[model samples]
Target chain A: MSGSVLYDAPGPRARARNLVLSVVGGLLIVGLVALVAYRLYDKGQFDGAMWDIFNYAGIRENILDGLAATLKVFAMAAALSLVMAVVLCMGRLSDHKPVRWLATGFIELFRSVPLLITIFALWVGIVDAILPVEVNIEPMWALVFGLAIYNSCVQAEVLRAGINAVPTGQREAAYAIGMRKTQVTASILMPQAVRSMMPTIISQLVVTLKDTSLGYIILYPELLQTARLIASNTQVNGDYPYVPTVIVIGTLYIVLCLALSGLANWIERRGRRAKTGIAPTEAKVPEQTGALP
Target chain B: MNVLLDNLDLFREGFVGTVSLTAGSAALAVVLGLIIAGFRVSPVPPLRLFGTVWVTLLRNTPLTLLFLVAFFVVPQVLFPGIDSYLLAVVALGMYTSSYIAEALRSGINTVPLGQAEAARSIGMTFTQTLRIVVLPQATRTALPPLSSFLIALTKNSAIAGAFNNVDLFNIQKVLSNEGYNILVIFIWITIGYLIVTFSISALFRTLERRLEVAR
Candidate 1:
């Protein structure tokens, strides 16, 4: 991770300076930890009972349910958004100006709005107002559609960037062989684009997974929402277990995202090492576009 | 449309809150991000480790979870009397700083190796070389992505609305409960957000053009 070129190898005095800086940095981190620990101890946050709330069968089940709910939304949204991205990407690159304009508008609008607002608006509009009372609309669908719409827009842009990264010569060669524009894009450029940008696409999938937490706002029983319920409803010795609950759930999210990111990196490495007649264009790293894109 | 006019005060309040949240968080993120970027490129091993750890943990975690921690956890364990607004700003700031740092680090990497070597060849120390040469060029390359990260920060402030800050997203919840039409409430919210985000992008584009160097 070191951009070592920025500096020469440390001489004796420079080594001494680095050692001093290291000590100071380490001390700062340790001091912050000690302060937080002292505060927690003063507040009885270290109490065993505070953390024992996880021992309850109902609470464990609720946590599991929340995990399942979050994954359910993520899986559905992931699949739906990918499909929608392709369609939107097609329209975005369409020969028709109107289609391209419509695609661009949809992307910019959704990407600009907050995911929390999109899900909340969708929950209110779709389930509360638009749907007939006879047809029960689950909050889950609202969260899923909201995520799908916002993420699909981002993914479409990523796809467009990827497609643009493809060399012009590949397209011209396709054209010289009498391929139509659609055929050239689909059969030639799109595959290379998708391959070149696989890392970014997966990275965005990680973003989608993280964003499913916004389902909490719409009252969907995702991990964050469930953590709130468990923390608030089940007090431990007259205090809410916010600290323990958050630590546990937040660790779970970190693990899941790290795993997904590891996959993205692995694919990126393998892609780089692959042999091919036409080399994959090195696509620029896509913007980390959400909450958390 | 009339509904927005009727509750114009609420929209105005929300607008102010959103802008304030974005501004506060952006300031914090820039400061923290620059520090982390410094750590990332520094010769110190522990400092680099700290930067990497901070980015990985924060960037991987969802913003909503950070808000949850900021709102629910901070009051209980870290700070006793922090208000929701401050908590929201801190959460958004901390979350966005990771991305900003990553953007800045990549920008640093984009600086040509020969430039650093050339600086060293001329008898410049690491600090002098980095200060006068590397950082300036890196910041230029990093401008576009850094601006995008700031835009993401603006969008992220919407999560604050869910946590009791009176921003545009929260305004929808308030207006809808008042029996206003969802479509109309959303329309206004959308317009407010579009204005903020579009303005940010346009401002950045102008800065990019102004900052353009012959290199």
Candidate 2:
């Protein structure tokens, strides 16, 4: 029904042609899936014993531990990244040209580099080489710092956009009230900016959560790494449990990301409800017009 | 500096590998994304469901997990003779295509209902209208986000380095193992990535400016 505006109702011949195309497409997809499954079965990936490895208590414990470790790193990285985001956002919005340029350069440089390389470099170059042995740098710390560095830059951009979204009249009114620049930004601008951008901020945190899996490259005992260790070390009929391990690990990631997005959606809905609950008609108009530019 | 000079060949090979991997995966992703986007907007119910399900599954899972499946499970079970590089390309392509499809679908939504209605009134078939009038405008608006996705893909192609692929990151890893200065090596690799990503950003910026619709 929604597409009715795009085209006229299909005639008998056109409808028949559409039906044929759909059937063919459906068959092709089914055939492809069947072929892949058959190949997997032939390779013993579907053997009951391949999946039985997860039945062991030790394996379950290992997975839980890995999950916990991943969450731990993510928690630290998320908090630190936000703190750094605030600092970088402020610096980028600084009054001094030199300070702003430096902050901009740092953000752009880190943003452009791949997260994997950043983590690897932090692990091998700075933590291993420069940190004093007495300081005891861990892979966990390296990963945390690396993730924070990249994510903070991204968060700064999001925050900056939110700040820019605030209307010019608000800033002018704050200035007319004899407020200092810092006072205006801190009190008048930032709170409103963060409230408006809360959804974007939360989604970026979801990105950070997924990015924690990248720690596996540096031998961090994260979920994916644990899956790799278990799959390669345990054997069933002379074959590793690669299929089952990947399936489990991938499911865990999917669940975590989906939950995070669900939370984001809930927050966004609550924000919308709060606004419209007060002045339904007034709140709706600005939102519609805000999206125009 | 001397470390870089001495290992120029290794670096060059690694650079070429990175470029090829990014290019291969990006090309595959664009095609798959277009198909998925088509499925999403198609009049058929099942096709729309399939598109929705595919995007949700792929978009939620981490790229590293997909790579693990590709490198460890897929090759052994399905295509035993497939090289690690190709497997990496497939993994990156599949993962990135989900994002690309979402971007394209959003772009299509921006194509005004009036335009489509006009095309239909002029007796254009769905396919003809999409191909001739809709997609061109959709792609023009989608250019910025599509370029961002490609840039992200280039960065992610480094994950392939974790496998046996001799990409830039892998070469840097080998250099560090051979007792090269870690800081210097990291600097060079960072610069390599920066150059590629920035060039992509600049190219897209230019495209966006040139393709701006005249009001």
Candidate 3:
């Protein structure tokens, strides 16, 4: 990439102009870093001594519990949402107008509304009212459900697009073989659609994973909330020890997202190796040769 | 019911604050996003890395945490005397900017190489080609996703209420807890948010259709 860029080397005037922009850009980035650093120093944000507390049995136990709860909720949510996404996609693509309309409305409503609002509403209203017995619908459940609802909508759209993008001839051939609409959709369409839409599905699931942290606001005792509690309770110098906690939690999140990205890249490369469909270059450009004999 | 009805003026004020916060943050986010998007696409290695790291951090972390950190933690720690509302705006603006930046960068990537090559063949500078040819096309490509980001940003601003800010959702929560009609309070809040999100989505749909035709 560097070789190609240098090969198309800029003229002197262009180089000078780019140099000016580069300086300004560098200054801006440095200024942002300085601002964060200044804030940390002035606020005494790094007062937490997590290293010392790391040996404490109680705090360690809580961390383990929190990690379990986080994973449990995330797994349940992702599984539920993927199932919901398939149903919703089918509904949206159905020949029946009512089904399509209902699917569309659901998708629009959940996707438009904030996840926080949905969680709060469901926790306060429906779950609290109907299943107040034998069902402890904690904020954790609310967060997971809310995430599932929103991400399912997004996943549904992705699936619908992928289904549509499949070659029209596949459907025609299936029909000619006397396959019904449902049969065609199940046997032919869904498999191809799933393959094509896997990347977007993984992308939305990564979103779901990150959104698990939102449960902290409603006191879900997720990883983020654990960090916050630990930071507040532990004192190294002074104040609430927010900066170090944030840094720790933020770093954890970065690692998770990068891991997901790596997985996505791997899957994408595998897909390329599989060569599922016609390559773009293989798409013949039509030409008129004056009604070629 | 009557208490809630009578306190409609207070609700309206809160609604205004919510609207203003959404509008202000969206505008700020767009400007910040464009700058970051430019940085990510720039030739400079460190600048590109900065853009990537910024997006990665902001994108992965919860927006609610960012808001709380800005309002409750940051001020208490850094600028001890600063107000929560300004902090909320700054946090939300920065939070939303990261997603918008990603959208715009993807949009820029989708612009055909031929368009820039055509622009430069006539002796246009790289900057000139980008400004005159690339950005306009990228903007059109970005409009749909940008619209969705705006919706997300608006909805997330409800977290301001969590931080004791005088926003619509917070006001409703207060009203509901004060022996006012809880249903009415929530109903109004839902309706208010619905209008904001749906209308913006609708407007964007129209713009998208127009851009499709124009392209």
Candidate 1 has a TM-score of: 0.94
Candidate 1 deviant stretches above 4 angstroms? A126-136, A180-182, A277-285, A288-293, B121-125
* C-alpha local distance difference test of each model: 0.85, 0.83, 0.73
Cα lDDT of model 1 by residue, B1-215, tens digit: 79888999999999999999999999999999989988888888888888999999999999989988888788866777988888988898999899889888888888999999899889788788888989889889999898888888888898898888999988989998888988788879988887777777777789988889985
Weakest 10 consecutive residues of candidate 3 chain A by summed lDDT: A283-292
True contacts kept of each: 0.74, 0.57, 0.25
Q: In lDDT terms, which candidate is top? A: 1
Pick the winner on TM-score between candidates 2 and 3. 2
Expressed as tens digits, the lDDT of each residue in B7-119 for candidate 2 is 99998888888888998999999999999988888866667778898998988888888888888887777778888888998899998899899888878888888888889
Candidate 2 local lDDT, A51-168, one digit each (tens): 8888999999999999999999999999999999999999999989999999988887788778888898877755556555534557899899999998898888878877887888
lDDT (C-alpha) at residue A255 in model 3: 77
In order, the interface RMSDs are: 3.3, 6.1, 11.0
Screening candidate 2 with a backbone cut-off below 3 angstroms (N, C-alpha, C), the clashing residue pairs are none
- Candidate 3's docking class is acceptable
